[model samples]
Target: MNDFKQELIRYPAARITEVAKALSGDLRVRILETLGDMPMGVSQLAEALGVAQPTMTINIQILEQAGLVVSSPGANREKICYVTCKSILLELPVKTGDGLHRIEQIHMPIGMYSRSIVRPTCGMAGHDGVLIGSIDDPRAFYMPERTDASLLWFSGAGCLEYLFANPIPPGVPLDELRLTAELCSEAPSFDMNRQSDISLYMNDMPVGTWRSPGDFGDRKGKLTPDRWFSGTEYGALTEWKVTKDGGYVNGIRATGTTLGDLSLDYSEPIRVRLEVGKEAEFQGGLNLLGSGFGDHPQDIVMSFVRSIDRQ
Candidate 1:
């Protein structure tokens, strides 16, 4: 096994062709499976798989290039190969050309929150994985460097609000509004069992609440920098959506709030707020991970779907 022991990896669309091509060969597939069982030298792998050294070397090169396997120099200059991920996840967009709807998406960085109300155990970090300003200091959220934050966390109760420019074309009827983020409970160091109730608001209207299972730190996040060692490695990807009917979180009904309740207008900005209310049963706080620090290489994403037929 590798030193990092990375368990899950999510690839971006840019690498789909390379990864798919690398796995196209049966020999390369077998090599990865074998390495998953145990790291081995090239010669040993060749012998076990009934392949010659030259063939093994070529196959290993492909896997290495695809980032499916990692090889390090061993004694006698022999190369030791190890599988990099136990599980791989990729999100593919599905496009249906029926022309019934148009979808617009925008990525909002975690640090770009326009307003915040936080307390102790609150801080932000940039892509460098270094903490900005001081830890547990609310003032840190106001630092100019905040716009560069790739990750942020807080304990107790507070709210972070962001304003997203409306992307729907004027006079178009909205169908569904969706927001997604990588999130989890916050704890000092780390605790997998801690729970937190996180709430979402759109245009100052309560949307719903999500009770996160825990703060995950069992393994290092796929995108978390090697330099980051202050705990809280990754988070669960959560999506909240609002439609004409009601609000939903991952397909489950979360609130009676509806799209009409938000009174969205294409000319106005959308105010999205995430908070941990003081009255919440679980005041576990929250950790919001960005593209540079989570298993998913994305920040807060919002999607606006417009009804093509409705004027």
Candidate 2:
């Protein structure tokens, strides 16, 4: 449907039990199948499935909790549910012959940026989707409560920088470093046709730039709060990886910049910057999503993997 956003969802083994419990019931499975075609009200689903409205509501809540369904208020205050994920990818943990930690990860919240220089159409919202300060005010970014932001947007051109504490252990010999975040373009209300060129930098070294397809608001996000009816809903998950050979975006080489160019220092914090330069061909702006406001339930994540041989 034109009014829905669907994407594959990836989960780790730790969440397998919760996801499995949600799909264990036959009725819940049928509900997902039905919603796959269209969004439906609780009463509508109940009628189609030959069940009482209360029963349907209960099942819907279960699916919603598991992030399989997202619901919003429809006419007459009725709850309308939409399927949020096209598929699910479960990643099982690998067993290491020797007991040791080979990977280190850190999650950074959106509002925790060390510096933000944004233009108009800029603002941030807390995990509950409530505005932290006056919308479109650059000074709003400096608010003390901004640290709780789950969603942030800016127009024209600007940059958001973050400083993360180095997580690599001393003399670990890193093999690869990865950074991932949910992001998209920004538009008034929402425009599927909008596009934006966004760039990323690691420790002041240029990583690469990516073109965002559009500002998606057609449907609610799985983890997005129901109270948030803002035009922007969800974003695509973008990742930047650095290896000894070069820098890549989504596994495709984007630049000759190698991991060595990053000049990562274990004794210092890591700096990350996401920006839309004034010279960008597509100046549509940018929207960044955090754990409580996107289809993916994660914030800005950085993972450092140790060398295989050393592990």
Candidate 3:
């Protein structure tokens, strides 16, 4: 049998040793696992694992030095940390065939806020005018309808769908998929009582859901305009995730999904739909601001790519 170890040896010994050393310690492994889903502060990780803050800090530092972890400023001056690497590939006994290896990532790097002045009682619609509408008349300004809808509010349950001409190819092995967007609200306050649930879908299939704490329109001029300032306050910062098995929000797992999920084909016609509402009761609404809300809106971004890991 041909020795495949020789092929593996081609990788620098220092790099391999770094990867092994980072994985050798149980504490380091735990820290990496915790960061797999989302970024967390040292205090939160320590509290969750029932460990000392120093222990968590030490392990995280090691991981960071090894290039396995990344850190940034968190809410309220806390240092937030997240895993930078998702997977590792090991050389096997068999020689792999030569083929194309592609990795694609799409990001909608914009904040949410509205601009157009809609008349009171007048419904805000997208540039298309036939896509969808918001629940409340005043709230319509924030709906994800037009590329220009910078302001959006959702009370009870509401759904918005975006149409795209390019769809994903039918049979491509999918590696990892995620949908990230920034969200914040001013409402019942940033407490548990003031909460909102968000979900994503494709072809009517549920992708994932995230429950966010309301920001209780505490800070002035976050969502509502100075002129339209109503007494009702609510807010939240949220991220919704979807994978082959299922989905999650913040860091909690949500139900509904199966394995071998279809890979979205960007070359074909595609549509992405978002749903936001209260689980038991109408808690509050959401604000979506982008070029898509105006008379001449931009495209609602959707991305699809293939990888060898899935195969």
- Each prediction's whole-model lDDT (CA): 0.88, 0.87, 0.50
Off by over 4 Å in 1: 1-101
Ranking by TM-score: 2, 1, 3
lDDT of 1: 0.88
Residue-wise C-alpha lDDT for candidate 3, range 62-107, written one tens digit per residue: 8777667778887898888876655655333232221222433343
TM-score for each of the candidates: 0.68, 0.68, 0.44
Highest TM-score: which candidate? 2
Task: Write candidate 2's Cα lDDT for 179-274 as tens digits.
Answer: 999999999888988999998999888788889999999999888899999789999999998889888888889888887888788789989999
Tens-digit lDDT string for candidate 1 (96-189)? 3222226778999999999999888888888889999999999999999998999999987889999999866555677789999999999998
C-alpha positional error of residue 275 in candidate 3 after TM-score superposition, expressed in Å: 1.7
Question: Cα deviation of 73 in candidate 3 (Å)?
Answer: 25
Which model, 1 or 2, shows the larger lDDT? Answer: 1
Highest lDDT model number: 1
TM-score of 3: 0.44
**Candidate 2 global TM-score:** 0.68
User: Model 1 Cα displacement at 256 (Å)?
Assistant: 1.1
Clashes (backbone N, CA, C under 3 Å), per candidate, total 0, 0, 42
